[model samples]
Target: MRIGVVTFPGSLDDRDAGRAVRVAGGEAVALWHGDADLHGVDAVVLPGGFSYGDYLRCGAIARFAPVMQPLVDAARGGLPVLGICNGFQTLCESHLLPGALIRNDHRKFVCRDQRLRVESTATAWTSGYEQGQEIVVPLKNGEGGFVADQRTLDELEAEGRVVVRYLDDNPNGSYRDIAGITNARGNVVGLMPHPEHAVESLTGPTTDGLGFFTSVLEGLIRA
Candidate 1:
């Protein structure tokens, strides 16, 4: 499977995301932020970064990039899309996902190995995990708090769209301790934690995050 990893102007983890894709047995295609063409890739990852130096809010500016036009269209057509950290902010800004990531409650940047529970395995990126399974991955962000109105929050919980929930500790004060969530169709996921950073035991805290990449690959193959 060909997985495209988009690199915006200040993308920090595009290479790591590409490596994760390759490690999971998928072809990693480098995608430029200014290009609208998706290169016919089967899936796409919006890697974490300080795009445009996080100007005009975390992902506000990056959402207007030319590449986002096609990405938005493809994502709506059910193409698998994974957004991590800053990427998650972009997803929300693009209206592909709901809610917004705000400043951390503690008003500080946080980086740590965060424990999370798999709340749903229905999404393309999380099918490899068992429901309620626990895993740890690296989490790093300044404005990582997730918030939405009560209606949206309740809807997300009721629809089983909450893909992952923080365990033991809520590092960023995300509502309901949500670490990640999926779209209603389950093809799009936005996660705050960096799964790419946890794909290898040699460099990461654990190899638990490999499931995310492998899950998408397996789903693409089955399709």
Candidate 2:
């Protein structure tokens, strides 16, 4: 499988995402934000980082990049899309996923190893994890808080769209301690944590994040 990792002007983890894909035994394709092509990648990942310096909201401006148009359409057509941190913000901004990301409730940028519960274990990006399993990965962001209206949150919860939940403690004050969520179709997923950052044992965080990338590969195989 060939996974495309998009790199916006200031994307901080594009390379790491690609490396993670390669490490997972998949081909990693570098995709430029300004280009409209997807380069025939089977899946796409929007990695973390401050794009366009985060000037007009976390991912508002980055969502308008030319490369994202095809992704929007493909995502709607059931192509797997995973967004981490800034990428998650972009996915929300693009309306591919529900809810909004706001400033952390503590009003500060946070960075640390975060424990997350695999709530759904069924999304295209999370199938490698067992349901209710806990995994630790690095999370860093300012606008990482996830919020949605009561009805929307209820629907997501009731329908099993809430993919991952914060375990132990809520690091970003996301509603219902949601760490990640999936679209109704289960093809598009977005989360605040950087799984790509924790793929290797040498990394400080646990190597549990490799599950995410490997999960997507399995998703493609099953498709």
Candidate 3:
């Protein structure tokens, strides 16, 4: 499988995302923000970073990049897309996923290893995880609080669209402790934690995150 990792100006984790893809036994394709083409990748990842210096709002400017136009259309058509941290902000700005990420309730930047429970394994990105499985990955962000209207939140909960929920503690005051979510179609996923950072035991706190990458590959095989 070929996974395209997008790199916008100021993107810090694009390379790490690509390495994670390779570690998952998939070919990594480099995609630039200025380019509109997807390079025929089977999947796409919007990696984390302070895009456009987080001007105005995190991911607000990066969402308007040329690459995102095609990504938005492709994702709507069932192309699997994973957005991490700042990428999650971009996904929200693009309206690919519901809810918005705001400043942490504590009003400070937070960085730590966070525990998360797998809420739903129905999405392409999460099919590798068992329901209710607990895993730890790095979470770092200032505006990581996820917020949505009450009705929307209810719908998400009712439909099992909430894919992952924080365990023990809410890192950034996300609504209902939601750490990640999938689009209605289950093709797009957005989360604030850095799964790519936890893919290797030698470099990270745990290897639990490798499941996310491997799970997508398994989904592709089943397809």
Candidate with more favorable, higher lDDT: 1 or 3: 1
Per lDDT, the best of the predicted structures is 1
Rank ordering of all candidates by TM-score, starting from the highest: 1, 3, 2
Model 3 has an lDDT value of 0.94
**RMSD, every candidate, angstroms:** 0.5, 0.8, 0.7
TM-score, prediction 1: 0.99
Candidate 3 vs. true structure, TM-score: 0.99
lDDT of each: 0.95, 0.93, 0.94
lDDT of 3 by residue, 40-67 (tens): 9999999999999999999999999999
TM-score of each: 0.99, 0.98, 0.99
Candidate 1, residue 152: how far the Cα is off, in Å: 0.2
Instruction: Report model 2's TM-score to 2 decimal places.
Output: 0.98
lDDT string for model 1 (1-223, tens) is: 9999999999999999999999999999999999989999999999999999998899999999999999999999999999999999999999999999999999989999999999999999999999999999999999999999999999999999999999987998999999898899999999999999998889999989999999999999999
Off by over 4 Å in 2: none
